[model samples]
Target chain A: MHDSPDPGDRRDAVCVVGAGASGLTAVKNLLELGFQVDCYERETAVGGAWNWRHDRSPVYAGAHLISSRPLTEFPDFPMPDTWPDYPHHSQVLSYLERYAAHFRLGEHVWFGTEVVSAVPTGDGGWEVTTQSTGGGSSRTSRYAALVVANGHNWDPRRPTIPGEFRGRVMHSSAYKDPAVLRDRKVLVIGGGNTGCDLAVEAAQQARQVWHSTRRGYWYAPKYVLGRPADQVNDRLLKWRLPLRLRQWLYRRTVAMTTGDLTRFGLPEPDHQPYESHPIVNSQLPYYLGHGRITPVPDVTAFDGSAAELADGRRIEPDLVITATGYRPRFEFLAPELLDADEQGRPDLHLHTFARKHPTLAVIGLVQPDSGVFPLAHWQSVATARWLRLRLTDPARAAAVQQKESAKPLASWSKRRVVKTERHWFEVDHLDYLRSLESLLNEMEPA
Target chain B: MTAFDLLRFEDWTNPVPPADREVVSLLPEEDDGRPPLLFVPGLGHGAWAFAEHWLPHAAGRGFPAHALTPRPGGDLRAQVHDVVQTAASLPRQAVLIGHGVGALVVARALGRYPARAAVLAAPVLGGWSALGSALRANPGGTLPALVGGRLSLSARQLFQSGPPALTAEQITGYLSRLDPKPRAELLRRATPPRPVGDAPVLVIGSPDDRVVARPALDRAAAAYSGAPLMFPGMGHDLMLEASWAEPIDAILDWLTKQIK
Candidate 1:
């Protein structure tokens, strides 16, 4: 571990990594709170995951917001009412660009510049080294605070299958167009939202579409009662119903809307609805029922073009699309800064504040069931306020720090811990939002 | 692909069957001092059609809202009885809001049971005439929907001239939830009588609705001696459309005046 720097000698400049939704939000909030901000983005544009044109973006040609527009858009700057209940990926990118331009966040960001290393300085600040993608000279700068908003979707979590398949195999991140699956026998692994979406897409064009899942996931329709599902959930929060009742209602609603999953040969959900992130695709079940797509058990092994299922069924797939999801990686930061808990998640308070470094905060690291934009907005607000308080009022900063430290650290893990690497940072959207709101209230005092 | 050599542990847990109720309450059943509201969906739709936004908003406004899914394969009269019984079983005399065929059911139920005011959204008035108009507008869709035991209209037909913000995924999701209406129900000669009883009616219509013609909506409103609340350039699915709040706000305002 690097030696600690003196707290009194830090500068006032703040270094924000990535120019994605979280980064742009941090820049706007930090600037509003009178902090000198510098943001770095590896891509040429501001929209991160929404930027379908960006090489690193995991969004495919048919990508759209899983959550509804009202729930996903920034509360302060909402998407137009004329837009559909759910907007496409291109529209989401345009919205993000509009947000950046509206807040003048682009001026503070360095496009095509990647943060190579972010090391803690001896003076309670950060020394950030950057390298331009154009192969120019590397530059190093020092700032009093560090904000990691690089996002977690860049690193693809590829699943391993036994034996070797000679057919084409690709991760979902590399998938850009459905034309690739045209007339090919395609097999999609994983039953998350993306996997189900890709399977449905392939069903339209592929010769045959087969979806494999290890476990059952609660599937939800994007719209219920002519409104977005997330928006309905948000309104239901006002009812102040007990948690059990709420879960029961959610399960009943889902069952009625989606019908039976076992009827379509899909495994029934192992846990209750809202226990983990439910698959919000409505087409998967419809396609399965119509025989356009076949649901199979987990893959046991691969033998050339023939793939063996756990139930001993063999399928000859021409193409394999792995929609297994992504892993969170921060190669620029020291490994010691992110100490993992028993669940392999970093031991950060509220999944934002670094345990050892008071000035270091991470925004948009959480996986919420609702739209991530609002959560990112609230997180940036809290982090910016806390950083400002640390400089102006040491006593208040200490009090806030003490409050965070005294609270139970692994409360979420204790509630419902799923033994999957993908669910390491999974959080119930409503529960996480309440925590973020409470933290913001304490930091801003209003 | 190289990451596959590692031993992976499989966590197998028993799957739990979901609740078996067809009716879903958006808010708790406990009375919140406001009149309860029962929502009935149109042909080919389940209770989820209103579960997305209307039920929650109405619930938030102090009205405990509930949605009912009419059992599949029932005749029109039987389905109407199912809806009426659901409304009657509520904690108190509840306001009935219905869409399309559901509106027709509410109109008929008004004559059979005592209730508060009713809001008919895109009501199918002059039953045969409305059906003719729908057939003319969607000949390719109408015949297949009826014969196939399900109704499946394209997203464009459903949300005509409305916001084009819905992703393809959402459109498919929305379309997948459209259940099949029984052929016997469609052929049954059971149109509700015009202006059944003296209950105040608020008829909602959209000019851009391709599924139900504007003239039919006007006639439906005229039958009840009520003014048609027209939302220009909107689609047939008013509750799910982009300007959903417009009709909701109108209903709330009209409900306030009717209560007074």
Candidate 2:
């Protein structure tokens, strides 16, 4: 499969897509594995999320991570303990920068290169196509191993608001800081964590803040009783129990653990065991309690300053923050390798390696309340090991792929583990790491 | 419990006593077992806060329920210790619930004991961070230490004097049950560098919350990689308010969906 490196090849050679967390990890690990690697990042700099500052950065410019330092960090590499429990978006970006530098991943990355297409060539190798993010440059290269570490948040998902809204409207992804909504009547849409956080922040600065949710939501306080709510809830749901009983228990447990909606001027939920919103903290209710924000109904339509809700209520809003979630963006890929379900999300197998092909692997695709770093780290390790095996021992690689292929795509939570069903790729970071290590061990020659 | 034991936890207070160590008593009858749901309370609150709000609602809705409170009486740290003790005693792997300052404690606990789902509500994140200072400065008694660890009865009586927006009576009863030490200690624990777990998170928040604020919860949830449930009308005492049932139900519903 050696097509022949140009008579003079100065570039050290493994192709990595995107220089985000997973991509960087793969690059670092590849170096550790002693392979010459080439990393292709669409962004100009090494930091992915970090580089996407509100002004110049793309993808989660205003967004901060939900994962904490200890859990967000790598197994061997620990983040500074001094960082807050929940670091700001900038801090995370900064941390990624530090990680890249420490691992020396910056030197190998081609900052402006974005992978446009990848095809498996003869001899089980890959031919890659690229477009420059800057200078409009285009090029093609071939690599023995390909690691697609392009993160999941690359694409933006806009909601189909049944009716048009005339008020100043923007997606949560477009929201950078709360400074833009000063003194205006702001309506924050969506029941997700970002919506809640933005609603709360806007409540303080805007003349009025209206948060709308179609589904009844649970405002999970960061702490319960005297600890973080996740710890308590996770503990309770981590068993073999009836789903009904578990839901019941979860309701009672959270209620006892946190405060009620009245404190925030919001209506009581109609449903039991309200769905968990991925909000960062629980203290948001206090802002509502103090009359800083108002919780309204789902927006049905809007005409200028006034917006109508599904509940038949109309409220005037100066601005509307549609923190409506996001979708996966894989525009650069060819139709053959890129297949998405009805939701437009790439139909990944185990959420990592592409289902249709094994040579092409995807990492950091799973969305969790905790940070993707842990998962990304383990995924990179697994992909690396798998690639190594495929290169040295194709038979073993084929066998492993066959077994992975045999497993059904939809499998989940024998216990109360919450993960996307389509991306049934959730793993306990620690367990996944160990499993990856074992897989790596099996690949070594005696 | 001794102070050191309170610090070490597990050794001093076991959520479930040794005698209560039963194997798999609460398994789901039909579906494959999801992780257990463990609920931890935020600062100045106890498991009773949730029970008062959820129990009546769950019963009305025909949902079976249980609320683990701070086993009758103890200091703040002791109650927190007891909570950890009692929670660990339950079946392994449950969704953990934490609110306000309590979210930090649960984060630490999860750091020690990994769970299935982590739902942090209106969290204060690290109460000692740059933003936390502002929250601590607010007059919500979140900073009970500023008034000295021991608040006078008249001063302590003021939290109830404010309004009926929340079930003040329930909040009062909850406050009357607390001893000074754990309250201060609990607040102190809500500082930066709070522990974290790798479980999927469902964060609940309100923009108008005064004490903990949305920024704190936002940052905390962001750290956890959790999905958020934001509302505009809720107050800091959400779990205890009249509108609390909806959010509580939402959390439970999400847990079921998540595990399924």
Best by lDDT: 1
What value does the lDDT take at residue A421 in candidate 1?
74
- lDDT by residue for model 1 (A1-446), tens: 11222432336978899988999888977886778788889888999877887887999999888987656766445565456777999998887887777556787888898999988886679888888975788877788999999898978888888899989999999999999999999999988899999999999989999999998887888877666676666566655576688779887886777677888888887787767766788888788877999999999889987999999999999899999998778878876676664433576888888988988888999887777887787688788889988888888788888887887844433336355677667776656666666665566542
Model 1 interface RMSD, in angstroms? 22.4
What is the lDDT of every predicted structure here? 0.75, 0.59
What TM-score does candidate 2 get on C-alpha atoms?
0.57
TM-score for all models, in order of appearance:
0.61, 0.57
Candidate 1 docking class? incorrect
lDDT of model 1 at residue A22? 91
B121-223 in candidate 1: lDDT tens per residue? 9886455655576676667766775566445565776775435456677668888877655354454555454332235888998877876787788877877
Share of true Cα-Cα contacts across chains kept by each model: 0.00, 0.00
The candidate maximizing TM-score is 1
lDDT, candidate 2, A1-446, per-residue tens: 22334632323356888887788888876765557787888777776655664233444434555544544655434444445555777777776776676555787887777788777775556777777775575667777767787765535556566566666788876777668888888988877677877877787678888888765556656655564454444444344355588567656765675556655546665554523324555656677667777777767766656888777988988788887666666666664464675555666655677766666777787655455776677667667767777778888777777766675533411223423332233443333443444444555453
Query: Which residues of candidate 1, in runs, are more than 4 Å off?
Result: A1-10, A341-344, A410-417, A444-446, B1-260
